[model samples]
Target: MAIVKVDNLSVQFAAKGGIKTAVAGASFALEQGETFSLIGASGCGKSTILRVLAGLQRDWKGDVELMGNRITAGKRFQGALRREVQMVFQDPYASLHPNHTIWRTLAEPLKIHGESEIEARVAEALEQVGLPSEAAKRYPHQLSGGQRQRVAIARALLLRPKILLLDEPTSALDMSVQAEILNLLNRLKQLHGMTYLLVSHDADVIAHMSDRAAFMANGVIERSFDRAALVNGEHRMAHA
Candidate 1:
């Protein structure tokens, strides 16, 4: 069962000096309940592809399907479609509201979707991310980097999304904190049977978290690798 299907996707930006191609003719698919990663150096179109799938960047040419439904460019995602997928951004500090309490942050999504039981869901999400309920009372600034990122994860999980698009989920954290967040993500995915589309530059992170990975460069996916092959130092790079 393929949960996400992208084909011939291309994105360009109108920079001050003419246009810049951020993603060109990229295509990939993600199976349900599996972790798929895109690995490459910075500015290699990995994050751009993630944003496109998340429906944040809609100006692109291609076919994007989630759960078998085609997602047309420029069509606003609403109701069930919007709720089915959620994204966890790269920068914890930037992604979260500095002044809002964690409780408010977690509850906002439920409120937008007109869902009831906000308190219960928020508490459960916090617990699921291994954060104490008291942590919800604190502001983003009051929490550690890992704790803040956990809150971000908790916010995404509150909606019970089927697919999670992660962008460098632990890049800003310390090594120990990175391990903790990665483990938390793994546990949550297993418990919820969720699918993941993670983007990162670190091969070790890709090996630790992904079942399969695509190496992206120069606005295209160059090659795909199984986790075992990547871990064993065996990979073949082919241009897209």
Candidate 2:
């Protein structure tokens, strides 16, 4: 069954000039345990869609559904909904709190959700993301770029979410680190039987990670690609 559904989704921002539409009637769906990606150039509204799913951008117009629940604007995500969907942001450094230690970063969500054994849970999350437990004691500034990103991934996983909204998850990392993070994400997804909605501008990243992908432009999803099309590199283009 489709775990994510979006129909006639649109988002607008009040720019200096006037009303600027970021996503205009964009729509797509993701099946359970599938990785669906959005590929496009910068400022094409791909990330906007992910923000909507992540509950970061709520002042939007359209229909959004996750795990069979219809989401409307201004609705705060709490309880099971919050636990079931998590987001890993694009910039690891910017996303993480500078002053917060890695342990606190990963432990906060578990604590908020009333999860037990905070210590063990934090250690396991770090290990699952290929980070040493000691790394948790350090702050974001004390760790390398790659390590910070790994912590971010671990934080997103602590909830055992069914859907992960990844917004340019590895864009800020080096090429080698990007590969590692992508592999880690794939492994975790398989291990947890989770679905993914990813937004990235790199065609190779989309082709490598996606079971299917949608090519968006301006503010609308222009077309979609299946595994076969992705393998054939049909989605590679100037805008992609």
Candidate 3:
């Protein structure tokens, strides 16, 4: 069975005396261990789609199903379904708490989910992201941009999510740090057998890492590409 499925999903918002559609009807499915990337220009509703899948924005019309269970838009998704789907935002600095140490930040999710052995898992999660155990003692300001982002990735992985929603995860980092984060994401996917739903505007980033690439324009999917077509840039979709 597909781990995640979105059928005829659409999202709209109330603008100045008019309703604007942020995401038009779109449909897709993700299987186990698959990396599907959505690439598009700004205002193309990429983040809006991720928000719908993450259950952060519920004011929408669609059937979002995970493991055969339907998800209600804009509602607080709970239970195992919530844990199975996790998101890593683009900004690590804003995502991490300035007051909390790395250990506390990473352990917060497990604590919220009532997962035991938080300490042990925090250690393991850090190691998985190539961060040292000593990193637990530092605050967000103490680390570099790359290190902070890795910590954000580690925090998401601490939940051991079945499907990861990454929204331009490496966009804010330097080129060198971007490569490191990409490598870490690729490695972690293999190690945990997790499916990834990555959203980015960079074609090269999407082409190099994703097993399949889907282009979004004006709130709709223009095309989907396989591995070979992505590398060759020979797909029918408009490259944003």
Candidate 4:
């Protein structure tokens, strides 16, 4: 079953002199427990699509349905819907609070949702992300790049979200750290039976994590193909 359905989506931004179209007439769907990726060059609207799905980008025209519920445009998700979907951004350093400890970072979401067992959930999330419980005592600056990203992932998973929107999740990390994070993501997906929508410019990363991928350019999806084709370099973008 399709967990995410986006149809005829379009997003425009007010630039210096006029409107800039970021995503135009974009359409796609992600099946439950499947990994779908969007790959393209910089400024090609891949990240914009992810932002829209995460409800961080407003002022757009489109129809977006998550688990059969329509998501109204230009509005932030709230309550149950917000808890159903979570996002892991590209920059772990920028996404996390420098002043807050990892424990506080993970605890805030649980508090917002009025969930009990916040302490246990936070500890479990850290373990699931392969971080020691003591790591939670440190601030973002005290951790390595990979460790920080793990904390970020742990924060997202604390809510038990069914859908994860990853915007270039490992782009800011070193190659070895990227592999570790990718392995963690794969293991977590299998463990939780979660669905993933990933945005990345790295074809190797896409091949490693996605079942299917779409190539986007100039605000529109130009092509899509199976992961195997992408892995073997058999697929080519129309704009390439």
Candidate 5:
């Protein structure tokens, strides 16, 4: 069964003069433990799709199913169900709290869910993301770009999410830093049994990390291809 599924999903916004549709009937499915990527040029609604799937944006029509359970827009699920899906954003700096230490930031989710074993969970999450236990004591600003990104990944892993939505995760970093983050993501997937829905404009990164690639245009999915075909440029296949 598909871990994540979207069918004919459409998203539109009301403009001053007209209605602007950002996503138009996009559909796709991601199986358990599969790494699927959405690739397209900027302003192609790649991030928009991720936002919708993460339940951050409503006002759309479609069926979004995670592990056979339908996700309703603007509805709160149980903490366990909510924890089953986690998102890592494009800018780690912005996503992280400036005032909070890494320990506080990482522990917030567990606290919110009333989990008492925050210390052990935080330590494990840090280790899983290749960070040392000392990382938990530092503020977000004290870390390098790559370290900060790892903390973001660590926080996501704390929940042991079954699916991870990665929105242009490495776009803000340099090539070297980007490579490190990508490698961490791969290792985390293996360690945690997580499925990834990675959204990026970089063809090279998509080719490197994804087993399948989906191309989006004007908020719609145009096609999907196997990873081999994508890296070889066989997946371009004449866009409409």
Candidate 6:
């Protein structure tokens, strides 16, 4: 069964002139352990779709399913749904709490879920993302761009989620750092047997990370590319 399925999904926002349809009848599915991506220009509703699936945007229309369970609009994720899906945003600086220490930030989630061995888990999470255990005592601002993103990734994985919603996760970093984070993400995804739904504007990143990709314009998916097409740089032409 597909890990995620969205059929005829639509999202609208109130605007001065009228209702702005940010996502219009978009549809897609992700298989287990697949890295499926959505690539497009800015304002094409790529991130909006991620928000809906992440349960951050509840007012949407369509049929959606995750891990074989149907999701209802306007409802917060519950039970396994809350624990099984996670998201990593484009900017680590914005996503992390500057006032919180890394240990506090990483330990809070485990505590909320009533998990034991909080200290060990937090340290293990840091190690999993290639960060030293001592880094946990530092704040978000103390870390470099790549380190911050690694923290974000560690936090997302702490829940042991089955699917990760990646919203342009590497676009905010330097070119060299971007490659490192992407490689790390790929490695973690493979090691954990998790599925990914990534959104990015870079064709090269898509080519490197995705098994399949969809191109969007004006809030609609215009086309799709398979692994072969991506490897052959076919999507680059259309993206260009």
Output the number of the lDDT-best candidate.
6
Q: For residues 8-89, write the lDDT of model 5, one tens digit per residue.
A: 9888889889998988989999999999998876777788888887777767788888888888866765446678988999
Pairs that collide, model 5: none
TM-score of 1: 0.96
Estimate TM-scores for all models: 0.96, 0.97, 0.95, 0.96, 0.94, 0.99
Residue-wise C-alpha lDDT for candidate 4, range 211-235, written one tens digit per residue:
9888888899988988678777644
The CA lDDT at 22 in model 4 is 96
Q: Is candidate 4 or candidate 6 better by TM-score?
A: 6
Note the clash tally of each candidate. 0, 0, 3, 0, 0, 0
Candidate 1, residues 62-128: lDDT per residue as tens digits?
8889988888898787667797898998899999999899989998888988999889889899999
Model 2, stretches more than 4 Å misplaced?
238-240
Each prediction's whole-model lDDT (CA): 0.88, 0.91, 0.88, 0.90, 0.86, 0.95
**Which RMSD values do the candidates have, in order?**
2.0, 1.1, 1.5, 1.4, 1.8, 0.7
* Candidate 6, superposed: residue stretches over 4 Å from native: none
Over 4 Å off in model 5, which ranges? 235-240
> With candidate 2 superimposed using the best TM-score fit, by how many Å does residue 135's alpha carbon deviate from the native?
0.7
Clashing pairs in 6: none
Clashing pairs in 3: 57-74, 58-73, 58-74
How well does candidate 2 match the true structure in TM-score terms?
0.97
